[model samples]
Structure formats: structure tokens, C-alpha cells
Target chain A: MKLTFPHLGNAYIAVKALLDELGVDYIIPPFNNKKALEIGIKNSPEFACLPLKINIGNIIQAYREGADTVLITGGCGPCRFGYYCEMEREILQDAGYDIGFITIDAPRGISLKEYFSQLLKITNGINIYKIAKAVKNTTEIAILVDQLEKLTFKMRSIEACRGDTDSVYRDFQQEIRLINGAQSIKKYISQTSQKLTNIRCNTGIKPLKVGIVGEIYTTIDSYTSFNLDARLGNMGVEVDRSVTVSNWVVEHMLKKVFHLPRDLKYAEAAKPYLGAMIGGHAQETIGNSIMYSQKGYDGIVQIYPLTCMPEIVAQSILPAVENDYGIPVLTLIIDEMTGEAGYLTRLEAFVDLLNKRREMAASDR
Target chain B: MRTGGQPIEALRKGMEYLAGQLGNIEIRGAGTTGSGRQLASVIIGADIVKNEITAHAVAAQNLVPEVKTILEIGGQDSKIIILKNGVVYDFAMNTVCAAGTGSFLDRQASRLNIPIEEFGSYALRSDSPVRIAGRCAVFAESDMIHKQQMGHRVDDIVRGLCQALVRNYLNNLAKGKLIAEPILFQGGVAANVGITAAFEEALGKKVIIPEYYDVMGAYGAALIAKRKMEKSIDTNFKGFDACLRDYSARSRECSGCSNVCEVIELFSNDELLASWGDRCGKWSSRLEGRPLVAR
Candidate 1:
């Protein structure tokens, strides 16, 4: 079967590795653009959210590129994401695309028997050892991508040469993209880290730190937010992202199976600002912002789609958090009409505010 | 199709205009707002560059100390700012739709062969306003055309359009907000008396228009610059002389990675003055000393 899936940041790297190791023929949809959004909006139900429409457009585009099987992950929250697979299937059927779908539910969320049965469909002909190796490689790939991204954030702020951090980071991504198997990832990380240390950064000036928190879809997708993290890094501000695709995989796939102590620290931190999960990462947004502030992050940037219920709720509560914690917060709501020019202005303004705050605090001390 | 020129040239002219108004006096500090704030900041070497929301709120607070709410409708967007004790407490901007903004009114007015300046006067004369769908632009346009085809008076149709814009603005923005008065109606759309009347009729309270309603964003930015100068050593303003120099901006797509970030470079007098636009600091990081042509 020719397989395909929607692009959601670096999640595609691990997924591509998995598909490659599975020896499956697959199609990766073209990057999102006006054409994709146009196709998506025309085909999707009027009231559906943006992500849903975009994914459908991706699937249709993939179909045109000869992909017949659509692979998607089951959701873990009350967000419309939990119902996306079924809704998309029905819509595709109505549109006359006879595509096969493979929806992978988190193994940790389901019984072992159910998990094994679902896994059986993909592993039908492969040997048990080969399947085990593929799983290991796939998880490692996720961990590696997360590591590279986080390192880029830290290195971008400190690197002395103009493009040193960026060139190294870009090269690392290219290097990893060509590699397969679990063993190569550890070596890749070490080699990249060594190269990073060789470059010098200014030691006299302290880097301003900012934390990113918001709805999962927007927060996870760099393209959606116009590569905001990297932009902050360009301004010499080190950004800490609370959510990553790898974090989600471990939380949803491995936590229960390993019987690991649940890291509910964020939920605890959010308890004071937001008592419970009101749906769609709102709790995490509050929790992570608090956590970042307590860790001495100078500011918080909350990015989400326009009219996103959870983020709007989170946006309302962020000012209180900022006031109480002595950190600045900027909430940026995006839509189809979110002009990059306006977005950049807000970001630069926020960064300027943070710098002024730092100067004032230092002078006070 | 390419009738509109680059923002850089317009920004230089705006800086020159601001300088002319101030009359050779050193701008104590400089701040920029609106969508082109970045280009303006780069061109003028501004000290503060803020969002239109913060800039508008500040301008309103300075002009009317008792303004509790601000309703801003510009060429392409609209928003409601709820102020508490002279601080920006809350705000909501229009999303996914541009129906209630000045551009729609401009389009409809031009379609009717009515000058945009006199469009509001026509609405003021209307007695029988029709109901036009303002939920979305496409529906609003078709509905307005339908009304006109039925031989409705041009003034009534114009009034109907104004009412529709106000309805869409309030429903989309001010729902459930503690939108108190002395409310200030500001932005480019504030020039339209029809919308001002519509707002007054709907809210059942007087909607005060600021003196420089169309330019409140700039006014607010100047206030921010004033506040900034009170605490800073000197202004970053590049001075009026910078406007005379020939400057150019070009964008190059970086094939560095999968993102393919496009980097922008600005040149003045054939020397590189500024470069940005890439998310990764690959190009911008190479920036050394600030370009000195402004001096």
C-alpha cells in the first residue's frame, strides 16, 4: 500500500523513519500552501477547524501523487482531533476517493490484546525481531529530532558567528534525514554537540529567555506560526518549548506500558491558575507558562489559531500569570489573514519590552 | 496589479512628514506601529516598535483619560479594546473575516460611484435602511447588490451597509466584554459618520471620535516614544536626512533546510544597512555595527 500522512512539524521525521524501516512504499504530501488551504476549505465541512481542513487537503494532494493508503494517529483529548479520522474518512468517501486508512491508537491507552491486534496488521509478514528493531529506531528518531531542536535553541543564542548555529543546525537536520536505524542517532547527536562547542558565543551578555506555550497544533507546527521559535532565537533570545512531538509520543505511548511515575508537575503548577483540563491543552498552556516563569524565563509567547476555545481561555488567564510571576506574556492569535509583517512587529516589540525590563531590573539591583 | 509600491518608500515619506511637523527638533525618541512598523523601525531607527493594539490603547488613554473602551476599525481589520484604570485590560481583534473594515466600505462606495469621503454623508441622509447580510463579505456584497437592483435609494443602501458593518463588528468583537464608556471610536473607519451613527444607535450611547481618528495608531506610537524617552538616555531616531538616501529591499530564498526561509536585505547608497526575514538567524546574525548613513 502507498501510505501518506499530514505534515505536523518534525513528527514527519520519525514517521518517515518508521515507514522506511517497515519497507512500505509511501507518499509524503507537498508542504502546505494556499493551494492546499483552498482545496481543504472547498472540500471540508463549513464549520470544521483549520487543521482538519488542511489535513484533508494534504490527503487529497497525496492521492494525486499516487498514495492510496492514509495513515493517521488516534487522538488523546476532547479536541475535535479525536474525531478527525472518522470525519475525514466519511468526507473522502463522499468525494469519491477510495483510500484505505490505518488509524494507530496509542498502545498505552489500549489493552495489550487490542494493541497487538492493531500492530498485527502492519507486522503481518515481517519477523518479530525486525519489527522490534523498527520500533526502536522510530522512537530514537523522535528523541533525536527533539534533541537537535532544543540544542539549536540554546546554541542560536550563544554562537558567536552569524550563521554558525544555523548552519550547524541545518546540516544536522540534513545529516539525520539520510540516516536509518537507532544506533546512528546517538553518534549524530554527539558529533553535532562537539561541533556546537567548537563555535564561540559572547560570554559577557546574558541571553534573554522566552517560553512558548499554546494549542498543540499551532505550537507543534513551526510553519503554522511562521517559525516563531527561530525568529526569537535570531533576536538572541533562547526559547524553551514545553511541547514536542517526542514528548507526546512518550506521554501517550510509553508512560502506561513502562509504569513510569507520571510527570503531572505541569498540572500541579497550573492548579493555581486553572484548576482542571477544560479541553485542548489549556491546562498545559497555563502549567507550562508558570513552570517557565519559575525557571526564570523572561517572557512567555502563547500562539494559537483564532477562535481556538482553549487558547482564548488561556489568553484570558495569561495576564494574571504574567503579573503574579513578574514575567511578560504576549498572546498572538493567527488566522488565514495573519500577515507576517504584523506578526514580526509584535515579536520585535515584545523582545524590546523584555530587554527594557531586564535593563531596569539590573539597574535596580 | 502591482500598483502599490514597496512599504520602505512610503515609510521614508512618513518619517519625513513626522519630522516636518516637529520642525527640525530632535525627536526625543521614536516608536512605530501598524503592519509596517518593522520596515518603519528599520528605516527610522525607532526606539520602540509596538503592535497596533498597544499603540491605539495608549493613544486613546492619553487623549481621553476616561476612555474605558476603544473600538478600532482600520482598512483591513477591526478590534475592541477594553481598558481598566488606564491600562489595556483586554482586547479582541477580528479574525477569518474582513467584512466590517474600511476596505469593504471603500469597495462598495466606489462600486456605487460615490466618493468615499461623501459616502458617510449619504448614509446620514437615509430614512429607510434595508437589512443587508454582514456575517461574511460575499453575502454582504450580494445582499447589497440585491437591494440596489430592487431600486432602493443609494443613501438607504449605504446606510444599510454601514449598519451591517457595525453589527458584524460588535458581534464578532465586543461579545460579553465589560465594554464600558466613554467609548472612543477610532481608526480609518472612524472617518465614516454612518458607522459612528450606527454604533451610537446600537450601543445606545455616544461614541466619541478622537481628534486624529484616522491617525490614532501613530499618535499612540508617539506617546509610547515619549514614555520611553523619559527613562532612556537618547532617541534612536535616524533623523530626517535618512529619508533622502536611495534605499532598496530584496528577498532571497534560503535553501538551507526544509523550511526554505526567505531572507530580506536592505541596501542604502549601495551599502548593506539591514537584513532580516529568515526565522533562523543565519543571515541577520551576520549583522555587525549599525549602518551609519543616518548620521
Candidate 2:
């Protein structure tokens, strides 16, 4: 059976490695584009969030490429994401595509028998030993890709020549499309990171540090966030993203299964503001905001789709965080209707504000 | 100075008028702000191009050094900027909606066959104002019509419209922020006394309108230009004579990729000055040698 999955930042790279190792046939849909967004808006419910709409577009795009079954992740939360896979299956079925769905939630969320059955469907008669090896390789690939991206983020801020870091990163993305297995992908990532490290940087310059914290889907997916991390990095601001695909996999998916140690620092930071996990990274948003402020970030940017309940809650509470920490926080609510001009204006204005604040403080000193 | 359906023509006339008013003046530096800043900078050779939020905040700070909040409503956009210690602490702009701005007010005034300038006086004449929906422009228009049909007084309807716009602006842009005083209201819409009164009534505080409210963005651009000129070796100002030159803008969809970015090209006389709006810099970067507009 041919399989297809929605894009989630660099998670696709790991998924590709896993499916390849499993010896399963799969198709990666075109990168998030205007057509995907258009199809998503046309097919999705009027009130649904942007990520779900985009996922619809991705699945439909893949269906056109001869994929009959769709692969997606599931969750149990107050956020609407927990219902996405079920809703999408019905939506697509009503639209008359007759697409099959394979949802992979946390094993704890589903019965062991059901989880293994879903896994076997994708594994295609692979032995348990092979499956375990594939999972290990896939996890390593995810971590390596995220590490490479973090290096790119840092290099972009300090590179002596503008676009130097971007050029290398872009070339790596283009080259990765042809490489197949996890080992090759891991090797390519190391080479790219080395190139990023070799780039000449003006180390003396203390760039303004900005932390990006928000909904997991929007924050991780560059398309949804309008390439926010890259945009800030290009503007010479040091960017620290609160979430990454690998981080999510480790913290949410693997930590419980493997009984790994949890990093409660962000949670402890968030305790004063949000004690409980309401759903969909709301606690993480507050926790990361407080963490960034304590780390002396110049500013924090919160990005989320319009009508996202969890982020809406987080947005309201951010002002309190800003006041107590004396750090400026910019909340950008985006959707299909978000204008590029207005978004750019807000980002530029935020940067200018941070610069002026720094200058004033320096003068006062 | 309004674009009035023809930005190039309006810019030409505006610059020529300014030149006539200040004849024989040597321009040391120049900058452009507002939505059409890129186009304006290309036409007049601006040394710096800034966004409206920064422009508005700077101008407000220049006028009232202790100002804490700035309420700006231009033709198609509105913004709320909160300042602390002479620095922009926070700000929000109207997102994907233009429900309550000067253009909407202008359209409503014309629909009522009232002079736009006199629309506010009618608001002041009414004591009992009707409530109108202000969530969306279309809804507000239909609601206004329903009020008019119900025999509401024109003065009261006008006052209701002002209050509706103010409510929409506050609900949309000023959410969860402390709008501390002294608040400065500046923009084309600040000329509307009705909006000013509504703002005061809603916030329970007096709103101060700057003397040059209509041109505050330009004023801030000038202030920025002055500061830039102090440290710069030379100015990019092409002088008032550049305003006399023919300028035109054209847009074409690039089919190089699936993105289909609509690249805009600005021209001076018949020469291709610069092109932008491409997601991939292939089209815009072609004119890298020229003084490209930096948004």
C-alpha cells in the first residue's frame, strides 16, 4: 500500500528515513504552497484552524500522486488536533476520494494490539529486529536534522556575508531530496553543519536575542509561521525556537515510552503562570516565554493560527509575563488571510523597538 | 494627500505642492513611510524607508515626549502603539481586516451624501446615539442602513457610526494592553472630531490630536531623515526635480515556479528602476545595483 503523510517541519526527513528502512512505498507531497493552501481552504470547515486546512491540502495533493492511504499522528488533548485525523478521513471520504488512514498516536493512548496492527501495516512483514533498528536510525536522523537547523540559525545571525548561511542551507535541502537512507541523511547533515561552522562570523557583535514560542504545529512548520525563524535570522537577530520536531518526538512521544528523564526546567519556569497543561502547548508557550526572559532574551515572539484556543489562552497571559519580566513580547496571529506586508511591518517594528530599548538602556548605564 | 485611485499622480501633485510651499529650500535628507513607502522611496529617492508603526510612534514621541499611547487610523489601516520610557513597548495593527478606518468612514459619509469633513459635526449634535455592529465593515454598513430605515436621526446615526468604528478599533487592536495616557491620536482619521469624542467616551480619557495629525507619518519620516543625515556622508534625496519626472508601477506574475509571486516593477520615465514582490529574489535581485526599496 502506498502511504502519504503531512509535512511537519523537518519531521518529514525522519519519516522518509523510517519508511525507506521499512521498505514501504511512500510519496512525499509537494512542499506547502499556494495551491495546497487553496485546496485546504476549499475543502476544510470554515472554522477549522490553518494547520488542519493545510493538512487536508497535503493529503489531497498526495492522493493525486497515486497514494491511496494517508499516514498521520494522533493525540489526546483539549486542542482540536486530537480530532483532526478522524475529521479529515470523513471530510475526504465525503469528497469521494475513498482514502484510507493510518493514525499513529502514543502507544499509551491506544491498545497495544491496535498499535502493533497499525505499525505492521506500514512495516510490511519486516521483523521486529529490523523495525527496532529502523526506529533507532529514524530518531537519530531527526535529532541530526534539528541539530543542523540550530547551527544554521546561529550561523545566519553572525555570518559576515549576508545569505551565506542560507545558501548552504538551501543547497543542503536540495541535495537531501535525492538521498534515501538515514545514514546518508545523517552524514549530509554533519557535512552541512561543518560548513555552517566554517562560515566567517563577526563574533564581537552581540546580536539581539529573540525567542520564538507558540503552538507546536505553527512554530515548527516554517510555512505556517511564514518562515519566521529564517526571517529574524536574516535580520541578524539571534533566534531560539522553543520547539523542534526532534524535541517534540523526544519530549512528548518517546519520553513516556522509553521512561526517559524529563526536562522540567521550562515547566518549573511556567509554574507561576500556568500550572497545568491546558492542551496544545499552551503551558509550553508560557514556560518557554519565562525561560527565554530569564535567559535575557531581548524579546519574545508568539505565533499561532487564528482561532487556536490554546494559543489564545497563552496570548492573554503573555502580557503578565512581559510586565513581570520587563521584556517585550510580540504576538502575531496568522491565517490564510494574513497579509505579507502587514506581517513584515510588525516584525520590522518589533526589531526597531528592541533596538531602541537596548540603546536607551546602554545610554542610561 | 490621498492616492485617490492614482498613486503616481497623487505623489507627483503632493511633492510639487510641497516644493511650491517651500521654494529654494535645499533638502539635506529624505525618507518615506506608510504602505506605499517602497513606491514613494523609488519616486523621490528616499534615503530611508520605514514602516508606519515606527513612523507614527516616532512622530508621537517627538510631539509629546511623555506620550504613552498612540492611536493611528489611516485610510485603510489602523494601529495602537503603547510606549514606555520613550520607546515602543508594544504595538498591534489591524489584521486581515479594515473594518474601521478612514476609508470606511469616507465611504459611509459619501453613501449618506454628507461631506466627509462635516460628518463629525453631525455626531456632536446628537445626544442619543444608536448602537451599530462594528465587527465587520459589511455588517456595519447593513446595520447602519437598518438604523436609517428605523427612523433614526441622521445626527445620531453619524454618532453611532463613529462609536462603532472606535469600538471595533479598540476591540481588535487594543486587546489586553494597557493604553496609558497621555495618549496621542494622529492620522488622517484623527481629523474626525466624532471619532475623537467617541475615543474619549469609550476610554474615559481625553485624546490629544497633534497639530499636524494628517501628515504625522511624513513628519516622522522627516525626523528620521534628519537623524540619519547627521551621521551619513551623503543624502539620497534626488531633490524636488525628481518629483517632476514621470513615474509608473507595473506588476506581472512570475511563472518560474509554483509560487507564482507577483513581482512589481517601478519605472522612472521609461527606465526600469527596480522590481520587487518576488518570494525568491530572482526578479528583485536582478536590479541589485540600483537603490532597491528595502521593506
Candidate 3:
């Protein structure tokens, strides 16, 4: 069976590693671009969120490229994300593309038998030892990719040369798509990490720190956020986000199956604002905002798609947090309708505000 | 509305007026802020360039030190900036909708054959105003026309339009953020007393219009330029004579990739001054380190 999955930042690297280890034939659809968005918009239900539409586009593009089966994670949250797989299947079937779907949902919601059957479909009759080894390699690749990205985020703000880090990152991204197998990807990541460390940086300048907190998919996908991390970094600000591909895999997938204790730092910090998960990372959004504020971040930026229920709740409550903590919160609601000019204006203004606040605080002290 | 060519004319006229009033004063610093900031900077050789939100907030704060909220509605866009402790805390600009901007008001006033400046006075004359939909510009126009055709007084319809715009601004931009006291209202739309009164009625707080309300963004840009010049003694003001030079702009779709970025090239009498709008930066980066004006 030929496998295909939606792009989620660098998560595709780990997935590629996994599929390669399993000796499965898979087609990686073109990176999320204007064509994908147009095709998705044409085929998707009008009111569906941006991520859902993008996923549909990715699947169809892959299908045209000879992908016969789709592998995607499932959620049982209060958000509409829980129903994405079923919706995509229905839409694809109606469009006459007969494709198989393998959804790996959290084990709590489904029987162990059903879960293993889905897993077995992916395993494709491989031995258990080989599957275990593949899983181990995939996890390492995921962590390495996330680590490299974090390093790039930090270095981009401090690099002495303006485009050094970005050029290296662009090269790394281009190279990874062609690299095969877990070992080669891991080796390439280390080489890219070494290249990043070699760039000259200014250590004395204390760059403004900003935290990006919002819906998981939007925060993870650079195409969705219009390359927010790189844009902020280029503005000479250090930007970090609470959601990464590895973080999502660990928090949502691995922890559930292994019965690992959930991380409560974000939950505890979020408690005063949101006591429970309202689904789709709403609690995490509030929690991360509070956490960043406490950690003395210069500002917090919250991004979510239009008509997002949980983030809308988070956006309303952020002002109170801003008032109490004396930190500025910029909430950006994006969709296909979001103009680049307007978005950049808001971002530039927010950065300016943070810089002015810091200068005032320094003067007062 | 100022076209691509009109800004040069407008800037020249504005500078000529200033030079006439100030005599032979030295131009210390120059700056540009707004949607046309990039083009304006290139034309005038501005030393600093900034976005309108920062410009508006800076201007309002300079005018009123304790200003907490700034409501600025320009020709095509509107924005609300919230400030606290003399710094900008948050701001929101209207997106993808030009429902209640000054241009919309201008169009409606001309349709009614009333001078745009006197349109607000007609609203003040009416005690009973009709209800108009403020959700979309097209709907609002049709609603106004329908009310006009039904023999409703022009004054009442004008007042309704003002209230509708105020309502739309509050709903879309304000969105439950605290519109604090000591609020300052500026921008081109601030000249309309009807919209200002509508804002006061809806906000339940007096909105103070700065002395130079219409030119506040430019004022802020000037303040920023002055502050910026403190560190560097050199000025890039290019003199008011740059305004007299012939200027033209053209755009072409780049074939360099699937992005098809429309690269804009601005020319000053045949010497290419600058080019921008390409995502890959191949066009813009080409002119770096070159003297801006060949003459």
C-alpha cells in the first residue's frame, strides 16, 4: 500500500523515516503552497477550518501522485479535528478516489484490538523486533528535528550575519526531502546543526523574547502562520512556540499508549485561567501564555484560524492576563482571507510595543 | 483617493506650503508611515520608515501623555490602539473589510450630492435617524439608498450612516477591549463631527480630537524621525527639491518561480530609484549600496 500524510512542519521527516524503515512505498505531496490551498478550498466544506481544508488538498495531490492509502492521527477532542479523517474519507469517496485510511487514534477511545489492527496495517507483517527498532529510530529523528528547529529559532535572532541562519535552514529543508532512511536523516540533521553553530552570533545583545501560543496545527505549520517564526527572528526577536511536532507526538500519542504521566506544568500554569482542556489546545494556549508571562517574555502572540472555538475563548481571556501580568498579548485570527499586509502590520506593531516597553523599563530602573 | 502618481504631487504641494510658511528652515529629518510608507520614503529619501499603527500610537501618546485608547479611521482602513503607562499595549486594525472607512463616507456623500465636509452637519440636524446595516459596505450603501428612495430625510439617513459606521468599528476592531478614558481620535475621518458624535454616543466617553487630527500619522512619523536623528547627526532629507524631480512607477510579474510576485519598479527620470515587492528579493537586493539619486 502506498502511504501519504499531511505536512506538519518537520514531522514529515520523522514520518518519512518511519515509512522508509517499514519498506513501504509512499509519495510525499508537494509542500503546502498556493495550489494546495486553492485545491483544498475548492473541495473542502466552506466552514471547515484552514487546516482541514489543507489536509484534503494534500490528500488529493498525493492521490494523483499514486498514493493509494492515507495514514493520519485521530483525536477525540471537543474540537471538529476529531472528525477530520471521517470527513476526508467521505469527501474523497464522493470524488471517486477510492483510498484506504489508517487512523491511529488514542487507545483510550478505541479497543486495543482495533488499535493493534490499525498498527498492524502500518507494520505490514514486519516482525515485532523490526517494528520496535523502527519506532525507536523514528522517535529519535522526531526529537532531533525538533531540537534543530529550536536551535535555529534561537540562533536566527542573534546571528551576526543577517541571512546566515536562514540560508542554512533553507538548505537543510531542501536536503531533507531527498534524504532517505532514519540514519541518513539523523546524520544530515547533525551536520545542519553543526553548520548552524558555526555562524557568528552577537551574544551581548539581549533580543526580545516572544512566545507563540495558539492552536496546535496552525502553530506547527509554517505555511499556515506565513513563516511567523522566521519573520519574528528576522526582526531581531527570539521567538518560541509551545507546540512542536515531537511535543505533539509525545503529549498526544506516546504518553497515552505508554500510560506515562501527563506533564502538568502547562496545566498548572493554565489553571487560574482555564481549568480543563476544552479541546484543540485551548487550555495549553492559556497555560503557555501564563507560563511565558511568568518567565518574563517581552510579549505573547496568539494565532488561530478564523471560527476556531477554543482559541476564541483563549483570545477573550488573554486581556485579563495581560492586565494582571503587565505583559502585552497580541491575538491574530487568520484564515484564507487574512491579508499579508495587515498581518505584518500587527506583528511589527507588537514588536515595536515590546521594544518600547523594555526601553521604558530600563530607563525607569 | 491618491493614485500611485498623486502622492508625489501631494507631498510636493505639502512641502511647498510648509516652505512658504517656515521660510528658509533647514530640514533636519524625514520619515514616512502608512500603507504608502515605502513609496513615500523612496520619493522623499526619508531616513526612517514605520507602519501606521506605530505611527498613530506614537502620535496620540505624544499629544496626550496619558492617552489610553486611540481610534484612527483613515481613507481605506480603521484601527484601534490600546495603550497603558505611556506605551502601546495592544492594537487591532480592520481586515479584509473597508465597510466604515472615510472613503466609504466620501462615496456616500458624493452620491447624495452633498459636500463631504458638510455631510456630517446634516446628521447633526436630524433628531430621529433611520437604521442602516453596517455589516458590509455594499449592504450599507443599498440600505442607505433604499431609505433615501422611501422619502426618508437625507439628514436622518446621514445620521444613521454615521451611527452604523461607529457601531461597525466598535464591533469589528474594539471587540470588548476596554475603551478607556482620555481617548484620542485622529485620522482623516476624525474631521466628521457626525461620526465623532456617533462614536461619543456609542462609547459614552468624550473622544478628544487632536489639533492636527487629519495629519496625525505624518506627525507621528516626524516625531519618530526626530527621535531617530538623536543618535545619528546625518540627515537623508534629500531636500524639498527631490519633490520637483519627475517620478514614475511601473510593475511587472516576475517569471522567476511559481510565486509570480509582482515586482514594482520606481523610477526618477529614467534612473531606477528602487524596486520591491518580490518575495525572493532578487529585484530589491540589486539596488543595494547604490546612490538613490543619480543626479
Candidate 4:
């Protein structure tokens, strides 16, 4: 049976590993792109969020490819996310796509007995212990792969700033993939670390640094943001990011749900700045921006999808934060047709200005 | 629940402290994703922009070696993803109604003079669920009132509301797809016990709620960033302190065409950085860094 879950931060990695272990046949839709958006927009309600449309588009593509079952996540919250499964089912039915629809509602504080029983229904009595082992292996692999990839990318910028980044990255990806096959997380980490240390690059005189902020999806997904990270790196500048899937799940999902102290104090500290909960992660985004600015970053960039409500609220209030902190903040609104050249030019200019400012500061010092 | 002057300032200070700890990790390049990516890219001077699907999928693949299904629910929407091996195969989303969402419950709670915090606990105590139309928020409300008038207990009514929402959700979003076990339920809504119970009852299955439900989107984005960051030789990050500058936007009606598009111009300390909104690039072309102007 093909099982699937809606796309989220790091869910694909976790689920993919488990499925592989279970030996279940499944298919993942292509990354969100114009085609996904096109199908989604054509099928979805006009006022739906971009993510929803993309997801619908993904299902359409999957069904067209002969996939039968669609797996869904279950939720209950003040946000509109909890009800997506029902709506999507209707849309697909109306569209005449016949397929199996299942939803796995994660238990909040309930016992695992019920959940395990449910699993048996789908797994047909597959070894739970085997499943557990697969999950463990997948998690370890995922973390290791993620960390290595991040380090390699970081090293690329550092190398590229001084030149020869293209060659370095080419070799790095190959080496890291080999290391990813390691049997343990420690082995993977050490192998990857050794690989990174061997790479050499000329470090440029300190370049200006910038912090990125905004809605979670928009800030981190390159397809949505038009590969802005690569563009920035190509411009010979350094960047710092504060969001991650593991941290979000571990800190917010686990901690907030369980009512535990958050590892990142800023989340707790920024709670009050957000005032009434506007829903989504707008509060955290704004809080991070404020935090980044105060810490003396060169600049900050805020990105959001067109017409996102919470982000609009954050945008409306960011001026006050910017003024209070005295940092340059640039906000970008993206849609399907957002031009690449236009985006790049603006970034190039921003970096130039920042670079000049840094030089002036150095001279003054 | 903190509010007003002191809280905001205190939060800012706390953020600063965190920023200080992050140190000077020069960003080579940055990318933006999710619903609000546009504004995020512009604000952070992103060199690349991507959609949440690609970003999330990439992140998930990086995190999990082999995956099967992904369940994602967030503040404004919900979705189901099916993955076979390592590729995304199928997915669905719900965006129109708020009937099964947390905000709907919150609204219902205030309307019924019940504290939202106690909603789930109350639902658990329900002996028999009252029938409430969960097809739409307005219908559910009227139906709930009618049920109350008919002498239905509050707990039963609440439980019924939860079930109705679950039915509506399944009927609408997951209509024609096959679902499998080992499902990961994520996003902010996963926190609700009543809804969780309702889903379990509907599916007759157990769902795994990931450790980070509320901030999964951000975390996913961050994970992607981490990958991108690691591969790069330099970073485009402008440093933490750079965020504390005056950024402003102003909109004006473009009279160049019948569209009369409201052109928005972004500024940082009196300098125009970017402009958008004109359909034909009328206003956008005139902006300082825009290529149309340079051409």
C-alpha cells in the first residue's frame, strides 16, 4: 500500500526512512513548482493558501501517475490546518479520483496501545520491532545527512567568497553521499567532519552578515523564494539562519504541547512582544528579527507569500522594531511570476551597500 | 499573555541575547519558503526563493532516509502527503473552511462562555455526543444552540462538535486517497486532544504526533537552510544586528493603466529598495535597484 503524508518541515525525511524500512511502496510528488501550483490553483478554491494549492496539485499528479492511497496527518488547533484532510477528500472526490484515503491522528497524551493497534491494521502484523529499528536508523541517517549537507553548503559560501566554490561543492556532495552510508550517526558525523576539514578555501576579509526572517515556509524553502540563498552566497556574502525543522518540533511541538521550558529562551522571551496570538509563526519570526538586529547583524531580510495575513500583521509592526533596533530590514513578497533578474539585482545592491558600510566601519575602527 | 510596553521591550532584549549567542556565521546565500516567502526573501535579501513543498520535501528527505506518509496541519491549512521510497507521490490540502480548526473551537468557546483552555478536558468527559452539523461553522453554531436547547449536556455537545469536524475534514480533504499506518501528525492543531480523539475514532487508527508540531514549518525551513548553509562557501546573512533598521513601505495608485494597481515601494532609511504591484512593471521598473530601470 502506498502511504503518504502532507509536506511539512522535516516530515518527508522521517516518513521516507520508515516506509523504506517497512518495505511499503509509495510515491512522493515532485517539489513544489509552477506545475504543482498550476494544478493546485486549477483544482483548489481560489482563496486557498499557496501551500494548500500546491499540495492538491501534488495529489493530482500522484493520482495521474497511478497511485491509489493517500495518507494524511490529523490535527486539532486554532489554525485551519486541522480540517484539511476532509476538504481535500471532498475536492478529490468531486474531481472523480477514486483512491483510498486514510488519516493518522497523532495522539496528544493518550496511550500508545490504541495507536499500535491501528498500526497493526495497516501493517498486517509486520514486526513492530523491525519498524522501530527502521525508524531509529532513518532518524539517525536523516540527522547526519542533514548536518553534513548544511556544513558542505556553509563551506561552499566560505570557499566561494574567495573563489573555487563550484569545484569544491561538486566534490563535497559526492564525498558526503558516501559518508551518509555509514552505519552509525557517530561514524557519519566523523566522516563528514573529516571531509569538510580537508577542503580548503581562501576566506575573504570579513563580509557583512545578514539575518533572514519571515514565515517559516517562505523563509527556508528555496523553490518558493526563488533560490535566494544561492543568489546571496554567489554575491560573496555570509548569511545566518535561525529556523530548523528539528528544533521547531523539539522545542515548540514537544515543549509547548508538554508545557516544558523551551531550549531557546528567545521564544519564551518574545512571547509577550507578539501580544495576542495572531496564529502561525509570525510572532516567532518577528521576535527572531528583533533578536537578530539587537545582536548587531549587518541587515535582515523578511520574506512572505503574497497576502499571508499573519505576515501582514508582522510587516505592519516591523517598522517600529526596525526603528527601535536601528537595523536595515528588507521585505520581499513572492508569487509565481516573481522575476529572477529583478530579485538578484536588488540583492546585489543590498550586499554592495552592506559591504561598503562594513569597509567604512573598519576604516573608522 | 504579557502585553504592552515592557513586554515587547523585554522580548526584544531576550532576542538580542539569543542572537549574541549565535555568533558571526557569515551567510553565503539564503533561500525563502512557505506562504509568506516573498516578504521574507525581500526582508532578508534572499538570493533564492522556493516553495514550501520542495523545501519541506527536501528537508524531510534529509531527515528521514526512507519515508512513506507525511501528515501536516498548520494554523491556516491542513495537508496529507504520501511518499514512496524517497519521492513525494501524493498530497491533499484544506484551506476553505475553519470548521475543524482550532480557531473554530476558540470562537465557539467564547460564544458559549467557555474557556478555550478547558475545551479538550471537557470533551473527554462527554458520555454521549450530541449531533451538531459540522459541515460549516455557522451551521454548527446554530445546531449546537438547538442541541443545547433540546437539553443536551455540554460535554456531549462538545464531543459531537469534535466528531462533526472530524467527519467534515475526512470527507473533504482525504476523499479519494489510500492512507497507510505510521502516519506523522504535525502542525499546531495536533495539540488538541478532542480533535485527536475524534480523528482516532474516525480512522480507527493511531497517529504519531511528531515532537515539534507547532513550529514544524519553521523547523523544516531551518533544516533546509542548514543544508544550504553547509554546502555553501559563503553566506548571504547580513548578521543579527542588521535587522534593527527602519524599513518602510508606501503604496500609491498607478494611473498608467485601467488596472490602477496599488504599487508598493519598499524603503530602508529613505532609500527605495524595491517596488512591486504594477502589472506591466510600470512602478516596479522605476525602483532604484530594479533591472527594468537600469535597462
List DockQ for all candidates. 0.23, 0.50, 0.42, 0.01
Q: What is the TM-score of each candidate against the true structure?
A: 0.77, 0.95, 0.93, 0.50
Instruction: Give the worst 10-residue stretch by lDDT in candidate 4 chain B.
Output: B1-10
With a 3 Å backbone cut-off (N, CA, C), the pairs that clash in candidate 1 are none
- In terms of lDDT, the poorest run of 10 residues in model 1 chain B is B286-295
Interface-residue RMSD per candidate?
A: 5.6, 3.4, 4.3, 17.3
Candidate 3 C-alpha lDDT tens digits along A88-128: 88988988888988888842366545655666787768876
Q: Candidate 4 on B224-256: residue-level lDDT in tens?
A: 566667766565555555446656767888654
Clashing pairs in 3: none
Cα RMSD, model 1: 5.6
lDDT tens digits by residue: candidate 1, B1-295: 0104578767767667767787867567888888766667777788887788878887898889989999999888888887655556556677657999988998999989999999999999999899999999989999999999999999999999999999999888886666688999998889899999999999999999988998899898989888878996687777888877888888888765545667888888889877777665556654434222110
Model 3 C-alpha lDDT versus the unseen true structure: 0.86
Q: What lDDT tens digits, residue by residue, belong to model 2 across residues B174-233?
A: 988898999999989999999999999999998999999999999998899899899965
Chain A TM-score values for every predicted structure, listed in order: 0.91, 0.97, 0.97, 0.80
**Is candidate 2 or 3 superior in TM-score?**
2
TM-score rank order: 2, 3, 1, 4
Tens digit of lDDT per residue, candidate 2, span A150-265?
88789878988666676677677768867898888888888888989999899799889999999888888877787788888877898988788888777766774566797878
lDDT of 1 at A194: 82
Q: Candidates 1 and 3: which is better by TM-score?
A: 3
Better of 1 and 2 by lDDT: 2
Indicate the DockQ of the complex predicted as candidate 4: 0.01
For candidate 3, what is the DockQ? 0.42
Predicted chain A of model 3: TM-score relative to the true chain A? Answer: 0.97
**Local lDDT at A308 for model 4:** 74
